[model samples]
Target: MTATVLTIAGSDSGGGAGIQADLKTVSALGAYGASVITAITAQNTRAVTAVHPVPPEVIAAQVAAVLDDIEVHAIKIGMLGGPALVDCVAEAIAGFAGAVVLDPVMVAKSGDVLLPDDAVDALARRLVPRATLLTPNLPEAARLLRDEAAGDGAAMQDQGHRLRALGAGAVLMKGGHGGGPTCTDWLVTDQGAQPFTAPRIATANTHGTGCSLSSAIAAGLAQGMALADAVGRAHLWLHGAIRAADGMRIGQGHGPVHHFHELWA
Candidate 1:
């Protein structure tokens, strides 16, 4: 039987990020993909012009419907637009036995804010605790920590430890915004901290990196890979996607990473 991974996120009409990216990444990584859309965005590679959030009840219903019928092995969550939806999702996934990878998607690549300010507290309190792994980029980690600390090596380690205290099984602090030749990701768990580094690929086509990475990790976990190994494999796959992105000219602005780069060529 194929492993099934569920993605709870928003929808991007341009198919770059959110639900579209999550599903694509899951499929590319050889996992069955399922989705529960929390919101819809009129967005392309250029900008997010508008957002339409799914009602809280509707979001809850979708979660219930999927969980009741399917035997999901892992779940990837992103972009809860409001507090109500956050609460709803938290309640729905309270007892899931499988791994849950939460990507706290606060801002978009275009500098547009995807999460509401008021919803941050709810996400921190309700959803963070339920996540098996929490993946936050530099800015999102800073916001979660509520500190203006620099993204230095020591600071990143401290941030990962602090975030791990918020009830997640582990925390992966991404170093994409650290402004260096190499991007380093720190993974902190009960055992110890593990850092994964890769040479930075300079490109404008990084629109859906966060979504893709989290979903890829979920796919790995669904296939029964250990947390550290799952993260390691996801890092490698995401790096390849970033490198392959230069070949595709999808939009006028920042384009998306090629999720199926391995299969295509």
Candidate 2:
């Protein structure tokens, strides 16, 4: 059977991030993707000008529609509009018994906030416990913990474990925001912290990176890869996508990473 992954996220008009990115990534990785739009954004590579939340009841309906007919093996969630939507999603997915990759999408690539400030608590308190994997960049991790972003490896390790305590099965602390020749992502589990590092490619076009990565991991999980292996494969794939980003020349501002880099070449 073909693996199936459902993405519950916002619709990005730019075709770069959010639902667009998630679906593209799932398809590129040879998985079937089903999506439920939780919000809609008037956004592009430059900025997000406006956002409108999808009603909680409607969001729940979408969740039910997908889960009812499709045997979804994994789920990727991003950019919940606020606390209410967070609660809606949490309650809706309560019975699902598959890998849930939650990318706590707080901000966009263009520096615009995708999720509001108040929604952080709801996400941490409600959805964190339900996630099979929590993928948070430094800023988001700090926001979730109400602490400073990790400044080094030790701090990253500490924060990863702390996030794991919040009830996620595992937490992956992403280091893209840090300055270094090599970017290292730490995956924290009950066993210990495992580091996955790749040489940081110098690229200005990293749009949709987090979304695509989380979706890719979901794709792997849907195809039956273990959590650690899924994360590692997604990390390597995203590195190539970022490396090939400039080849497309997407927009005047930050362009999107190449979701189909391998296939296009």
Candidate 3:
């Protein structure tokens, strides 16, 4: 049977991120993709101009529709617009027996605020504990904890542990925002922290990298790979995707990584 992954995220008109990116990543990893849109954004590679949240009732209905019929192996969640929506999504998936990959999309790649200031607490209170793997970049991790972002590897591990205390089965502290010759992502589980590092590629076209990575990890999990193995495969795949990102030239600002880099070559 084909592995199927459900993506619950906002829609990005530009197709570089959100539900678009998640579906693309899932397909590229040889998994089937399903979706439940929580919101819609008037956005491009440059910035998000406007956002229209889907009504909570509609969002709930979509979730029910998907879960009722499909044998979804894993769920990748991103960009719940506000507190009520966060609670809505959390409750909807409470009985799901598969892995849940939650990508706390607090900020867009273009530096736009996707999650509101008030909704942060709601997300933490309701959804954080339900995550099988919590994927948070530096600023996101800081925002979730109401603390400063980590400045170093040790700090990253500390933050990961702190986040795990909130009840995530594993926390992947993404290091893409860090400035350095190498990029490092820490995966913290009950066993301990394992670091995945790659040479940093200098490119402004990193728009949907975080979304892609988390989605790819979800796809891996859907295909029955172990969490660490899933993370490792995604790390390698994203590195290649980023290396090929500059060639796409999709927009005037930050473009998306090539989700189909391997397939195209």
Candidate 4:
């Protein structure tokens, strides 16, 4: 059977991030993509001008409508705008039997805050525990752990442990934000901590990288790949996308990665 992955995220007019990036990554990686738009943003590669959050009821309805009929193999969640929507999503996917990959998106590439200040607690208490995989970059990991000083490798591992304490089945500590010659992502599970490393690609076209990576991992999981293998494949794909990003000149400001690079090549 063909794999199906659902993405619950906001819409990015720029098409570099959020639901747009998620769907593109899913399809490019050979999985069926479905979406539930939790919010709408008037954004571009330069900056986010406005945000209009979808009503909580509407968000719930969208999720229920999709799960009722589709046999989704994995669910990738991003940018639940506020506390109510977070609660709504948490309740809706309470009994989901498939893999759940949560990208705790706090800030956009333009530094716009996608998640509300009040919603952080709700996200931690309600959604983090339900996630099969929690993908957080350095800043996000610090925020989730409530440790503004968590940056070193040791601290990152501790943050992973803290997230597992919060109940995630596994944690992928993204190292892109960590300033180093080599980008190393640490995957912490009940079994142990494993590190995946790749050379850092220098480019400004990294706008939708976080969203794309989580969604790609979800696609791999939906296709029945093991957790470590899924993350490894996602890392390789994202690295390639970043490397190809400079060619796509989608916008004047921070551009998007070439999601269809594999196809174009």
For candidate 1, write residues 1-265 as lDDT tens digits: 7899999999999999999999999999999998999999999998999999999889988998999999999999999999999999998888789999999999999999988778888899999989899999988988887887446877888888888899988999898888889999999899878899999999999999999999999999999999999999999999999999989889999899999999996
Tell me, what's the RMSD of every candidate? Answer: 0.8, 0.7, 0.6, 0.9
| Ten residues in sequence with the least summed lDDT for candidate 3 | 117-126
Off by over 4 Å in 2: none
lDDT digits (tens) for residues 9-118 of candidate 4: 99999999999999999999999999999999999999999999999989989989999989999999999989999999998888799999999999999999888778
- Between candidates 1 and 2, the one scoring higher on lDDT is 2
Model 1, which residues run further than 4 Å from truth? none
Task: Give the lDDT of residue 253 in candidate 2.
Answer: 87
Which residue pairs in candidate 1 have backbone atoms (N, alpha carbon, C) closer than 3 angstroms, thus clashing? none
Q: How accurate locally, in lDDT, is each candidate?
A: 0.93, 0.95, 0.95, 0.93
Error of 1 at 49 (Å): 0.6
CA error at residue 127 for candidate 4, angstroms: 0.5
- Tens digits of lDDT, candidate 3, 1-265: 8899999999999999999999999999999999999999999999999999999999999999999999999999999989989999998998999999999998888889999988999888888899999999999999999999999999999999999999899999999989889999999999999999999999999999989999999999999999999999999999999999998899999999999999995
Please give the lDDT score at residue 9 for candidate 4.
Answer: 96
Evaluated at residue 252, the lDDT of candidate 3 is 94
